[model samples]
Target: MRGTDWLLLWTLSLLWGGSFLFVELALEALTPLTIVWARVALAALILGLALRLTGQGMPPRGLWPGLLVMGLLNNAIPFVLIVVAQTAITGALASVLNATTPIFTVIVAHLATRDERLSPAKLAGVGLGFAGVVVMMAAGRLEGAVPAMAACLAAALSYGFASVWGRRFRQAGLAPMATAFGQVVASTVLLAPIWLWVDRPWAMQAPGAVPVMAVLALAVLSTALAYLIYFRILARAGATAISLVTFLVPLSAAGLGWLVLGERLEPRHLLGLALILGGLALIDRARAARPA
Candidate 1:
């Protein structure tokens, strides 16, 4: 990866890592459905205006169908599932489950297509990184959380499919802004009815300023701008590299906990970081060896 790719990788990690915080706050005032819907809807609106302001128009009509499927896979399914999972499992546990995205992506791509074959290096990397995540989170309350854990893993698998599916946008020559905009639009279209029926957002009491701001941050920072960076990186880095952000999100969350909330830095966290980095290096080496 280039320096810019690394920059965007870390930026995405921070943005998505922060989403757990926003989800927590938003949940105080909204249902998971409402939160998920608002996020993509607002992001779509913002990106739409940004596209117009930047003098770029919508992507070709032919691209909308694929983009809609991308939205359903990438944004709608995982977003809702993860949010619901958080209601049942701790966020750290959810992160650990979420870290499986690249593993799923690698395997899914390997089995479903021709190019992204699974290698020994990838197996080792996934094993090591997954182990690190387990240690970092020290998650043991699994007996009662099986359903939630499964839900989170389902979300990761959905993300895996989304990563592979999103590759076409590069071939289509769609701008990242347009791709991001289209994705959120489709997510909103698909989820709006569910949100309205389940949440009836209008009848709910007004959320305080804090929750409102949290939703805004979730939409603007994580959903909207993050997807812009997401597609840009995906276009350059491919599915495996982009999916590796799953591993970083947890690490970034731990870092934020240490820095912002003064959570103590344990040795296990450092060990986990080392393992994940080692795994990434192996993955990178494998990527370098593959024929492009």
Candidate 2:
């Protein structure tokens, strides 16, 4: 990736990394389902307006199935899991665990697509990434709670599949913005009634500024701008390069947590992060050695 692309990736990473913190704040007043619903709903609204404003057009009919799958995997399940997990884990730690998405994406892409075949390098990367997760789980003294960590890991695994699944849209001739906007709208439509029935958010007390800001941040920055940047990178960089942002998000999250939120990072967490980065390097090295 070019320097500017790298900057964009890191910026995307920071936005996503900060999402955990925002979710945690929102969860104080809203249920996980409610948070997920609001996030996609608001994001869809914003993107819909933008699409109308720019005359970008709607997604193709052939792409709707893929979009629905991506919406459920990428937006609904993982979003809710992360929010629920935030009630139990520190935002930084959850971000680190979530960083494993690319590793999983590599494995899933190998299984799902014929062209995106996995090599020994990718296998090693996947193994090493999982190893890092195990090490972090065993070695780190994390704040919040333990079960939440498990939930976050599950969410990361789901994200891995979603990342790979998302690539199908390109073949369907849908622009990145179209796919991003459509998927959020799909998720909102699917989740809204469920959210209302389950969470009954209207019956709850009014949210304070912090929780309101958290929801807005999740919707605007994390969902809307994040997806815009994601598709922007996808259009320019291809899926593999775009997915690399997964590896960087943990570092950005940890740094932001420490600097902005005053959260402490234990030594084991750093060690786990090092292992993940090393695993990513190994994957890249393997790819470099492969004959075209």
Candidate 3:
């Protein structure tokens, strides 16, 4: 990866990692469906216009179904699950569990295809990374939050599948911007009926300025800008390099919590973070050694 690629990866990490804090803030005002709806809706609006300006036009006719599936897997389902999970678990625990996405991705990819075979080192790395996450959660005192923990894990799995499913678009010849915009548009359309039936946006409380702004931030910055950076990084760097952001998000989340939410990171947090980062490094090293 070039210097610019590294910069984009880290920047993307910060944007996405800080999203937990933004979601927490937004949750004070909106339901999970509502927040996710607003997110994909706003992101679609922005990216769609950008697409139009660049003459990309709407998504191709044959791609809608696949795009909708990707949107559900990538954004809608996981978005709701994480938000609902946060209602049951602390953000720290949630973030730690969420960091397991890449590990899950490795396993899923290994199982889903013959090409992405797992090495002994990669296996060790997954075990170590999962162990680190367990240590982080245990250190953070996760006890008796079964439902929330389940929700977060489900979110991670959804993300893992989405990561793999999204790769198929290249073969489908859909550009990144079109793919992202289509996903957002599909997510918005798919989520609306459920949001209306369950959340009933009309009945939602009128949120104050801060919470409203937080919603917009999640929609615009986290969803839109983050995806833009993500696709760009995936284009410039390899998928493995793109996955490195997973190792950074928890640390970023902890930092954001300290700054914004006045949460304190204890010694245990640092230790757990070190283990997770170390595990990811090992995984990347193992991946680098493998034959292409």
Backbone atom clashes (below 3 Å) for every candidate:
0, 1, 0
The whole-model lDDT of each prediction reads 0.79, 0.81, 0.82
Worst 10 residues of 3 by lDDT: 135-144
* Candidates, ranked, lDDT: 3, 2, 1
Residue-level lDDT of model 3, residues 1-292, one tens digit each, is 8999989988987888778888888878778888888989999999988888888868788889999999999989999899888766656557877877777778889999788778888888888877766665564334547667668878988998997898888787889899999999999999999989998777777988987898888888888899889988887787888878888888788778778888765566566667766777877898878878
- Candidate 3, residue 249: CA error in Å? 1.5
Model 2 alpha-carbon drift over 4 Å, by segment: 1-3, 139-144, 236-241, 287-292
Q: What is the C-alpha RMSD of each candidate to the true structure, in Å?
A: 3.4, 2.4, 2.2
**lDDT tens readout by residue for model 1, 238-285:** 866786786688777666645654544457656766676667667667
As for lDDT, the candidate ahead, 1 or 2, is 2
lDDT of 3: 0.82
Candidate 1 displacement at residue 78 in angstroms: 0.3
User: Distance from true position, residue 5, model 2, in Å?
Assistant: 3.4
Clashing pairs in 2: 88-145
What is the model-wide C-alpha lDDT for candidate 2? 0.81
